[model samples]
Each structure stands twice: as structure tokens, then as C-alpha cells.
Target: MRRRKKKHEDEHMDESWLIPYADLLTLLLALFIVLYAASSVDAQKFKELSQAFNEVFTGGTGIMENPSPGETQPPSDGEVKSSGAEKEEKKEKADLDKEEIERQAFLKDQEELKEIQKKVNEYIKTNNLEVQFVTKLTDEGLLLTIRDNVLFDSGSAVVHSADLNVAKELSELLVMNPPRNIIISGHTDDVPIRNAEFDSNWELSVMRAVNFMKIILENQELNPQWFSAKGFGEFEPVGDNGTAEGRGLNRRVEVLILPRVTD
Candidate 1:
């Protein structure tokens, strides 16, 4: 009977160790579960998981008490560099888009100016005024140059009585849906003037520009605010001041139609 009891006791085989072994296995399983969840869960969940681990471990401390690998951290150098590159790429794209828009606007403005120039050229041809008038489309805008003799006598600022009809006809052409700013500038040859009516060439030039602008503003359809007058006496010349033909070209009144885009 004693031998049989001893055999039973030996067969018991220290089963108490199984409790700690099972606890170790449970801890390992929980650790693996936490590791897997940390990869996919948000920071709040990760912090909750850490708290659970601390409660399960000794003295409210555990390996998970430290930050999770997936938790918020400073950006790596490569990530920072990539962010900067993306910002720069976006800026370049925006600049390219702006440039394309400006290019399209410039093309449209050029076409409009060209159309106006063509109309003026047709008018000049129909009236046989090519010798006294010229039109040019430049970067500044449309420039319509009329010989001084066409509108005024030598050293005079008045538009000739016969030319009043011409001025009125020109004013009729300026009626537009959206009015543009017009600058009437008078230019003169280098010849000095001291007449009874005018003290100097500067005064004569100024009067000519003012008179031409007044004639243009006489049209009820035209806005007086859009018209301005200036004088460039013997300066801003387009021709040589020494030659007769060049002097004839220089002594003119210029009508400059400014682009609407500038406004």
C-alpha cells in the first residue's frame, strides 16, 4: 500500500509549475497582440494599450511604458526632404500656370490692337491720307501719327477750319463699348519758335495736344476722363532733326490708345 501511494505521489509530477508556465504563455500572447495592434491602431488606442500593459506588469511599469514605434516622432531626414521637394514642385507648377495665363492675355491684346490698326489703315486708304497719317502697333500700344500740317499751320496750335470735319470723323471711330484711355501728345521739330501767339515751341506743342484732345472730347460718345494731353517738344523724336523730310516726320501729333489691361 505504501509503495502504491509513493507511486501516485511521483506520478503527480510537480503540476504547480503549470500555473506560472501558463501565465508566461498568456503574457507572450498579449505582447504579440499589442505589437500587431500598435502597427494599425491610432495613438489614443496605443496609449490605452500601454496603460493596460503597465497594469498587468510589476510596479505599474512595462516595456510598453516607453513610446510605441508607431507613435508620433520627429520626421526623418528623408521625409523632411520629400516634404520640401513637394512644396517646391507645387510652387513651380503655380508659376507655370500664371505664365501661361499671361501669355494668353498678351496674345489677345495683340490681336485687338491689330484689328484697330487695320481699321485705321483702311480709313487712311479710303480718304487718300496716307501721306499725312500713319498707324503703328507697338509694345506700348497703338500709335496714330498725323502730320502737323494736316491739323495746324506752321507755328500754330489751332486745328484748321477745313480739318474740323476730319477731326470729327476720326472721333466717330473711337466710340467703343469699353472705352480705352487715349493720350494725345504733340511733338515738334528742333526749330525754335517765338511768335506773337506762342512764346516757344513748348507752348505751341502743348496747345496743339490740348486742342486735338478737345476736338476728340467734343464727341458726346467719348469720355472726357479717358483723354489726356501732353507735349514732347523737340524730344522723343522719331526722325532726325537736321533733315527737312525727317523734320516733317518729327512735327506731328500722336494719338496713343493705351491697353485696357494696363488699367
Candidate 2:
């Protein structure tokens, strides 16, 4: 009995058993605390704690709050795309407007040319003088062709009585609707000439052009400053000089009316 009592006192003095019991109680207390936290979770407090931890780890500001509920801001990417599209549309519209204005201006110029052509055609038809004169619209201007036989004698640069009436009628029309500039060009056949009065076809053609210009300038309605005369001799022939008809075509005087814009 004495030996048993001594052994029981030694066992009671050992602290190993108390340590295991304290550990079990501590684990049970931790489990209860976890269950209590799970049962009564605070969403706002959790979010704040999570944000604070993220800010500390990332070294940045906390998450921002939405300014208004159900009102989202437009994305920067989408805004930039829309702005570029609008600018492109405006640029295209400006280009279209410029093209339209240029087209209208071109049409207006064409109409003015047509009007001038029609008026000259009407004057030619009304006078019943198509046999002695030829009129046509060229790129340069309106051309009036008068036969050399009608205006001058062979190898001479004299203006005849019959030619004066023809010149006067044409001058009257030109004065009525004056152009920016008028050029009287004299031409002759390839037939060579050697005479006491004139040296060659060049002199004869130049004299004939001058004589015709003098008659046209007699009318005060015509502007002398806008008129000029030139002689081509047989250099700028309209047809081949091999045939009689071609020679007739070549031997003619032309009146060229130039546009104001060209001047």
C-alpha cells in the first residue's frame, strides 16, 4: 500500500497529461469561433478588409465606388472609335461639296460657249449668204472664211466693191457681240509670184489682211485695240495644193475670235 501511494503521487506530479487536455480545449474553442464567424458574416467589413489588403500588397489606391447605380460610363476605346468615324464622314462631305462646285462651274462655261455658237449660226442662216462665206465654231474661236477671189484680184491685195458689203455685214455682227480678241489671217495658194508691186505671196497675203482689217476698223462699234492681222501665205493650207478644189480651199481669209478668259 505504501509503494502504490508513492507511485500515484509521482503520476499526479507529471504535466504531460495536462498539456494534451489544454490542446484539445484550445482546438474546440477555435472551431466554435470559425462556426460563429461563418454564421454571421459581414459583407461590407469583409470587402473593406480585402481592399485594404490588396492596396497594401499592390501599393495602389483602393477600389473606387460607382458614381450612380445602373449608369455605366462609356469605354474609352469605344469613344475614340466613334470620334474617328465622325471626322472621316465630315471630310468626305467636304470633298463632295468641292467636286459639285467645280462641276457646276464647268457646266456654266459650256453653256456660254453654246449660246455664242447658236447666235453666229442664226446670223449666217438669216443673211442667205452661205455661198460667199463659210462659218464654223473651232476650239480657238468662231472662224469666218471669206474666199480670196471675193476679196482681192489675182496677185493684187486690193479690196473690191463686192467684198466691202460682205466685210461690213460681218463687222456689224462682230460689233453687236464683241469678243475678247479677233485675228484676221490671210492665206494664199501655193502659186509662186514675181511682180513689180509685190515680191512674193507673203507680201500679197499681208497686204490683203491689212486691207480687210482697215475696212472692219472703219466701224466705230468695233474695238481697234482688240483686233490683229496676220499673213500665212501658203504655209498653213487647209487642203492639199495638188487639186483645183484644194487650191480654192487654201486661198481664203479667216477671222478667229478668241475668248476673254484665254486673253
Best prediction by lDDT: 1
Q: How much lDDT does each candidate structure score?
A: 0.87, 0.75
- Give me the runs in candidate 1 sitting further than 4 Å from their true place: 1-72
**Over the stretch 1-263, how does candidate 2's per-residue lDDT look in tens digits?**
45543455545456689889998997687567544533444545544444544465446554322122323335578798999999999999999998888777656554665676676667777877566577776667667888889888888888988768878877876764545588998998899978998888888888899999999989888889999999999999998899998898888888887654321
lDDT (10s digit) by residue, model 1, range 1-263:
45543355545456898899999999899889888867864767777777877887755787777775648667779999999999999999999998888888888877888888888889899999999999998778999999999999999999999999889988887776678888999999989999789887888899999999898889999989888999988887888988999999999999998876631
